[model samples]
Target: MGIFDKIKEKLSHEFIDIIEWLDYTDDTICHRFERYQNEIKNNAKLIVREGQTAVFINEGQLADVFKPGTYTLSTQNLPILTTLKGWKYGFDSPFKAEVYFVNTHLFTDEKWGTKNPITLNDERFGLVEIRAFGSYAFKINDAGKFIVDIVGTDNNFTNFEINEHLKSLIATRFTDTVGEAKLPIELYAANTTELSETCKEVMQPEFNSVGISLEKFFIENVSMPEDLKKEIFEYSRLDKIDLDKLTKFKTAKAIEAAATNEGGTAGAGMGMGMGFVLAQQMGGMMAPQMGGQQQAPMQQVNTMPPPMPQAIQYFYSANGQQAGPVAFEQLKALFANRTVNKDSLIWKQGMTNWSPLLEVEELKAFLGGNTPPPLPGS
Candidate 1:
């Protein structure tokens, strides 16, 4: 072969004729077509497979974008690139331009989580901190815009790079949406589906700004502090508790304790008091049940002679001296004569200390009926 023939063969070999990409790594979002200083020959065949898009950048400006299809690089098909290159007429020589293949398939299982707890104001819980995490899916929508805005000069861009940015964006938008939602803290877990949809809607515009499409968003779990969780759980049981029954249960327990400690004087006294109170309660409870039996009134009447009455004596403080123990009738006469008044200290058998006459239940009867004036000083 002649020298000219050899040079033509070398020049032909130096130009790229077929421009395509076979993506092996599923994580790759964009891969630059490696030409190694070789220019693309005129009428070069551009192969854009399914789930992929071809973007051409000329002179640092996004020029032509091709969807999944076979394309021949020409003035007709490369209108934007041709115009940017000022090629009024299509050229026959090789052209130098950047070709990038962007993955248009959904990139799923991208994780997003709040690194710090999101503070939210809840009506029942007040200010609460919660953390959330879940997976999301996305895809490149506008290849040209994506190349221009995010993947600039990135020869091989993987989802890892973009995921970090997307996760931060998702976290921010998630916090904002959750806070604005104002849902009860306890409902966050139960309503994750609704919250996820709302978060997707809120973050779609952010993704769109950079030519990405948020295909799916999810909130797998929302969690609060363990203590807060326990508190919420306990609060939920409040309506289930029967306070009256609980009080009775506590009283029964106290009585049991008093009965077990018969050795101590204090315990004995407590046992006696508890027994009296318990008897009164039992009597009150039985009254209704007995009355409901429809028994005739005569059946409840006593058939035996009544027991003799025991008189209760009283004592009074007269002129700073302890007076004799007077009968109840005599005590009433003393009160009527103004020898003792409601304020006069009095005591009775089994009484712990002297009490004001007005404070005594049995003596209160003396103050009723006709009013009597105080006697003149003798």
Candidate 2:
């Protein structure tokens, strides 16, 4: 070959060598090449199977190399590196990568926690406590909106953030749906399971935008107002008042029975007094018949004459001397008929013994001016 041709061939070979060197040094010298490689690796996406996960590795970064299974991406594995120096010398891994969705069911069961199921009775005022853990199955159905408006492409999303958003979404949708349902407050207070189901049904469409399938949901617990609970308790025990009134009525009836028994005893005493008066009247009628009968067989009979009428002796107030005669028969008759109350004495100690002072006739005669002298101080 001629010297000019040799020189041209040599220039061509040198140019090819420079191109190969540029390709080799692209990771360090070309920002576009580095970004392109990063995009390719990061976008190495996979559809997360029901029981599996997917992991994405950066081309050259210090990172933990994962097994071939899918894994949920977390903050623990971030900032995928795309340079040889970062892979070899940096504390971080060259294979900076993202772990895709992991099947949480592998590590947890229904007991771990579950989504609350919706029912047909949830209301606006109702509250429910829901329990769930780990990342849930979701997809960015509206990729463009999710990347641009909902969550920026540069932003790293987390399960906690997703859960919070989900909670807010659920609450808002539940409130709207409950308002539309126009359910009674009583239903909201009483039916928690129904409320949860209704909430799920109402929230399904809203969650669809975020690609959450709402696998299952339940109302772990419900909290109600204390005053409402107290009202319910009072209503349930309403019979207590009636029972108290009945007890009082029974006690009153028992007291009335006791009073009736005492009154009956008093009536019996009155009846006995009436019987005695009746007997006295009947005896007076029989006395005349006995007086008319006489024995005709009398031979030598010794008969006693009627007793002489006794005189009542009185004493003078000045000397306490026996002073005058009073008819004892009249006084005795006055006492027996109760026309004179002999027991009504005004005598004091050191005075004379009890003695009759006035008969009923004496009282009448004194009033008619058949006077006796006023004695002593009188």
Candidate 3:
């Protein structure tokens, strides 16, 4: 039997007092009231709750849209339906029409993600592949158009029917937006806000055309393949680290480790082995230069560095302003010029606090002529 006939058969003895969708489902985006089989009584109360809207459709034609409020199904209130029905005066009889309730609230936390990796050409890594996942929100802006285009005349339109289509649409838009952007994959996480805004701008027109509004789009994470991520990480680490410094530190640590061993065969003895290897290499190289002469004494090849003199520097403070770590010669000039006096505070590498120059043994000679200046408070 037809839908109307089935409803008529079920409600043959009685009639609906109120025409409204009282209980709505979470998954259902729109619901066509099952009163198709029964006639809508004149002056029937139509309740449109908050975040909801009621659309009246007459025999394959869209009529008036009722926002969130109590609507009285009268000829005066429904001028479009009344005109379509060709009612000269207000008819008090029942009428046949379809009513659909649309959910217009912002649906939040809806997930959108890539199932497989999306490959992009990267400047640093050549061809790179990445996957992104995030949440989005939307609302029904045009209820009549949504009913006409998406929900249609179905008894109920739920998320199950539209989930795949929405996901596919979002993915297509994202792919287009990302491809056109040519953004580096590594920057996706950092540039999520900009990317999300761009995606929304690119997708709004298409969504609006279908009676829905793309409210908010967000990208939470963009990840590459495990191997690719590891490679990128290693590349970043290698780029930031100084190879020369690393080599020097490792060599110094190796030398320190060797010195810590007390065994007679370790430490500087390893230097003898290294010296022997170096002498063999040197002999091989010098043999060509020596023109077959008898081998020279290997003891002459021992390479030891000469020790360097220790440098002593002094720092002085005058008038609350501290001065540099000057060498001994500069200190002598400063004392000769009287830039520093006998009581001027001076300090050096091993000293605790700044001491008067007269009290320091090193400065006595530079003081010149006559008895030494008395120490302060001595």
Highest lDDT, which number? 1
How far residue 207's Cα lies from its native spot in candidate 1, in Å, is 0.5
Q: For residues 6-42, write the lDDT of model 2, one tens digit per residue.
A: 9997545432111001122211111111222221232
Candidate 1's displacement at residue 13, Å, is 3.9
Q: How badly does each model clash, as a count of residue pairs? A: 0, 26, 1
Deviation in Å, model 2, residue 50 alpha carbon: 5.4
Which candidate leads the pack in TM-score?
1
Give candidate 1 misplaced runs (Cα > 4 Å). Answer: 1-9, 245-378
Better of 1 and 2 by TM-score: 1
Candidate 2 segments exceeding 4 Å error: 1-151, 177-189, 239-378
The alpha-carbon deviation from the true structure for residue 358 of candidate 3, after best TM-score superposition, in angstroms, is 64
- TM-score, structure 2 vs. true: 0.31
